[model samples]
Target chain A: MAKKNAWWLWAAAILTYLFLYLPLVIVVVFSFNDSRLNAEWVGFTLDWYRKLFHNEKMLTAAGNSLMIGVVSSLASTVLGTLAGIALHKYKLRFLPFLVLTPIAIPELLMGVSLVIFFVIVNQLLGILELGLITIILSHIAFCVGFVAIVVRARMQGMDESLVEAARDLGATPFQAFRLVTLPVIMPGIIAGALMAFTLSIDDFVITFFTAGVGAATLPLEIYSMIKIAVTPEVNAVSSLLMLLTLVLIVIASRVSPSALRANG
Target chain B: MTLQQRIGKWVLSWPPLVYMVLFFLVPTLIMVVAAFRYPGDYGGLAPMYSVEDGKVVWDLTLENFQRLTEDALYFDLFIKSAGYALATTLACILMAYPLAWLIARSPKRYRDLMLLLVILPFWSNFLIRIYAWMIILGPQSAFTRAVNWLVTGLGFEPIQLLFTPFAVIVGMVYVHLPFMVLPLYANLEKHDMALLDAAQDLGANAWQRFWRVTWPLSLPGVFAGSALVFIPALGMFAIPDILGGTDSIMIGNLIKQQILDTRDWPFGSVLSIMLTGGVLLIAALGAAVARGGRKRG
Candidate 1:
């Protein structure tokens, strides 16, 4: 009876996995479709991949997205790590709740507020441009919280006495942090950075609002492209993006599985 | 601690706090202000400075709130959005409970791999995933064709599947199932099967054992998963926009249309504020559930 019950459970699990993976598999399979549309799979070819590579607009958008992801991730990682350290080590009240507000708030509200903020700032200072900088800032604004949360969770698992031991060795606070704390939390920081990178890349709503006339990320480009027409090229680009995201998740999981779980 | 150490700690913590203040807190405050203010002659918040023969006039009004309360259309859209979120959350929970149970009960050797598989797709580009659904449910696609063939073979007319509320629910559940499953699995994995054995020894049947022990223990996961799925589903625009028909306009799309299409900031702000309030209420309820679950545990 137990075996029979487990068998049905395993069947359900398998079906669920299939449901999860089917769309991804279809995308990869259809990316190579010789036909222009995904409706019919005529034959397998690499023409769509070739087209994706050669499309200048797509390439530029990918570049823009990559740059934004890198910059925003780096900035958020720095701010988040510091904030994480502070939250973990200090007694500052209300800091934890304040840091968590962004993740709690919906993305649409964040995007709209940022847009209005930018408009008000632009009207006041006339210095703010709604382009790459705006996009990066907005991405950082959201990504920082996730990074800090991941880092703080990892830090909580750490033995606080290690830093105390370093301090007892007559090392200065900075030196103790540099030698003991930094190396210990390096994995968490790396995991946080990876999370930030993926968040920046996959971000759409926030980027959509902040990106003005001339700025287009890969997501924005894809959105506009699909709005116009669905072609095999989108499948190819999407398959590649999925591959990249999976690679990042793997790397993040390797660094700290708990951090990855916290992120999810 | 010394002043220098306090300063150093402050230095470490200040950047993110300052960033959040400048960008998040200030913007939200401005959004509230914008929502209450009159819309300018053009689109954004009412201009603070208006020049009339070298005289500057500042205009602020409560007309936006008045409009919001008077218009039933906004209330209908909110209800529709809530309905979509509710349907999506229910579907996700139904699907996730079994899968999460399976994963939690799986052998320890393969547990990590199973969990990884569950979460892997969640990291992918969401827009692309919805787009993939468009292909799968497209009229001429193999899946739809197969369904059509099966239906027609049974002497029934072929049904339209894509670009419907059904498609929207499918996409939302697809995107959100992991959110549900992950929390459920996390909670269930730590569950003590000994309790199940205890309940069984106490003469409880499978159904009674599950209800008395497992179900009560898993309430935290249910609450967490519901919040994760419901909040995002409430605000999701791309899923319905990509997979839904013209009739399926959630509050997210409504706000997007008002802000981007119509360039009406005050109306959009009002809608945004309303959406945020609704989300926060749900979040508070989820938190209460979590607290209750903790107390019981």
Candidate 2:
């Protein structure tokens, strides 16, 4: 009876996997569809990929996304690591609530509120307006919460006595952290940074509000393209974006499974 | 602690704390304030004070809240969004549970691979993922063609699948299934099977063992997965915007229009606050259930 039940579950599992991967696979496969229309596959060709490479706007948007992803992830990693370390080591009472608040709230609300704040600030203080800087700032704001949570989860599982041993051996506080604590938590930090990078690069709604006319990320550009029509070029671009994300997830899984697990 | 150590800790925390305050907390507070206030003559949020007779006059009002109640549209959208979210959560739980259970029962080496298969697409661009569904469910796509072929002799017209409520629900389940599965798998994987074996030895059948033991143990995962799915699904704009028709408008679409099209900042803020309040209520209820489950366990 157990074996019979297990067979049905295995069949359901296979169907579920198919359901998850089917859309993604179709997107990838159609990127090389020779016909411009997506009605039926005419033949396989690489013209769409070539067109994507030559499309200046698409390339520029991809570059902007990369630059913003790099800057936001780096900044978020630094602040998030520091916050995670401080919260873990010092046990700041209100820090967890403060850090987790962004995670708990809906992303649409977060995006709207941040846009409102930026508009207010731009009016009050003449220094800033919606642009690449605002987009990066918004990305950093949301990405930091995930990074801090993942790093802190890693720190909670760490052996505390390693840092103590380093301190007892006449190492300075900074030295203890550098030599012992840093290496132990480096996987989490790296995982967090990569996760930040992935979230920033793939963000659409927040970047849509924060990114004004001058700056458009890949997702924003894709949204416009998708709004106009469904083209093979869009499929090609999506396949490439999915490939980049796949690479990041592979590296993240290698670093720490718990980081991805902590995300949920 | 010494003063120097205290100062050092403060210094260490200042970056993230200050950044969050300036960005997240302050903006959220502004949203709350904006919800209570009114929009200016043009497009921005109205200032709390206006200069009248060379003096700052208070201009606060509860008009936005009042309007929210008076307009049945927002209330209807909220209820519709909740209904969609609830349906999506139920579908996800049904779809994810079997997959998660299979992965849990699979051999150890392939288990991680199966789990990764579930979560891999979650890292991709969310908008693009929804767009992928458009192609799959489009009238011209193979899925529709196959469905139409299967029912050829029935003398029924081909179904329009895209830009429909069913399509929106499908998109929601596709996007959120991994979220549902991951937490469920995490909970199910750590189960102590010895209890199951003991129950079986005592003549409890599979159904009894599962209901009395497995069901109670997995309540936390169910709660976690439902919270994750339901909250995001409620506030999702992209899925509905891409896959839903005008008849399927949800609160998120209304909020998006308020911000982008109508430029009604106060109304947008009001909707934002209401959505946030609803999500918090759900989370608090989930926590209560979790606490009750723990006591029972």
Candidate 3:
């Protein structure tokens, strides 16, 4: 009876997997279709990919995405690594709440609140505005939490004896940390940085609010194109974006396998 | 603690703390205050105070909150958003259970590979995932034509699938399914196989063994997964905006419209506060139920 029931479970699981992959398969398959319509496949061609390469707007958006991803990921990684260390080492109260609440709440709330905050700041200080800087700041604000979560999980799994032994060998506290703790958690930090970059590049809702008129990221650009009309060019760009994400995930998993699990 | 140790702790904690305070905490507080302020003539917010006859007069009112209550449309929209979220959560659980259970039951060597497959698509761009559905559900797609064929053969009007509430729900489920699967798999992987053996030995059949041994233990996972899916679904604007019809707009869309299209900052803040309150309440309720389950067990 148990064996008989397992058959249905296997079938259901297979169907669920198919459901997850089918739409993505369609997107990729139709990107190569010779015709503009997404309805039916035509003869294969690389025209969409060629068009995407020459599209100035798409190129600029991709460049902005890369710049924002690099800067924000670097900033968030440093702050979040400290946060993770503090969270693991200390019994403090407010730090944990500050680090985790942003992750817990709905992202739209964050986006709208940041909009109001930026406007108010600009009115008072006349220095801040909704642009690349604002978008980068918002990305850091959210990306920090994810990095902290990954790094904290790494710290939890670290062996304390190495640091202790280094300290006992007459290494100063800073030196002990530099020599022992840093090396142990370096993979976590790299994983966190990569994760932050992926998130910053892929973010849409917050960027939609915080982005200035001219500072369109890849996602913002994609949103505008799809809103106007669906075309194989969008499909070609999406396939490339998906390919980039896959590569990042592969590298992240190689560096720290548990980082992916910590994401949940 | 030594002075150096104190300084070390401060160095490690203060940067993130200050950054979060300035960016996350302050912005949230500003939104809370913005909820009570009046909208400016052009956009954003009205000045908080103006000196009239050399006196400081404050500019704050409850008009935004009141506006929400005056319209039955807003109330119904909240209910509808909640209904959609609830449906999405249920669908995710139904679809996630078998997959999660299968992964959990698989051999240890293959488990990581299976889990990776589930999370891979989730790592891709959010808009791309929604766009994929647009292709699948477009009028000329074979999937839509097959469904319409069945509907018209049954003497019913052929229905459009794209830009409908059904598309919204399907998009919600598609985007959030991995959230449900991960937690459920984590919970299910820890179950002891010997317990099932004991139940079987005691004459409990397969169904009883599952119900008595597996289902009760998985409630925490179910609750966690439900919260994960429900809260995001409730506040989602993009999924609805891209796939939903005009009538399928959720509270998130309304808030977005207020801020972006209508330039009603105060009302947008008001709606955001309401959403925050709702999310907190649900989280608290889930915690209480989980604690109650623990005590009873």
Best TM-score among the predictions, by candidate number: 3
DockQ of each: 0.66, 0.67, 0.70
Name the candidate that leads on lDDT.
Answer: 3
Please state the i-RMS of candidate 3. 1.9
On residues B7-110, what C-alpha lDDT tens digit does candidate 3 reach at each position? 99999999999999999999999999998898999988998889999999999999999999999999999999999999999999999999999999887798
Better of 1 and 3 by DockQ: 3
TM-score of decoy 1: 0.95
Minimum summed lDDT over a 10-residue window in model 2 chain A is located at A1-10
DockQ of 3: 0.70
CAPRI class assigned to model 3: medium
lDDT of 3 by residue, A157-227 (tens): 99999999998899999999998999999999999999999999999999999996869999999999988
Q: What is the C-alpha RMSD of each candidate to the true structure, in Å?
A: 2.2, 2.0, 1.4
TM-score of every candidate: 0.95, 0.96, 0.98
Cα lDDT of model 2 by residue, A130-238, tens digit: 9889999999999888889788888998999998899899998778878988899998999999989988998998898888778888999999998888998999999
Q: In candidate 3, which residue pairs get closer than 3 Å at backbone N, Cα or C atoms, i.e. clash?
A: none
| Residue range B1-297, candidate 1, lDDT tens digits | 899798888888889889988888899999888887777678776765578889887677778778877989889989998999999999888888888988787777777788878888888998898988989999888889999999999999999888888899999999989889989999998888888888989999988988889998898888899999999999988888889989887899988888877888988998898999999899999998888878867
Report the C-alpha lDDT of model 1 over A1-264, residue by residue, as the tens digit.
111246667777788899999999999999998998898779989999999999999999999999999999999999989888888879877667667788877788899889889988998899677999999999999988888887888889889899899999998888988998888888889999998999999998899999988999999999998888889899999999998997887787787777776667
Runs with alpha carbons beyond 4 Å of true place in candidate 2: A1-5, A254-264, B150-152, B198-205
- For model 2, residues B1-297, the per-residue Cα lDDT tens digits are 978578769877888999988888899899899887879889877788989999998888788889988979888889999999999999999999999988887777887778778887777789878998989888899888898887675877777888899999999999999989988998998888888888989999988998998878998999999999999999999889889989887889899899877889998998998999899999999999989988877
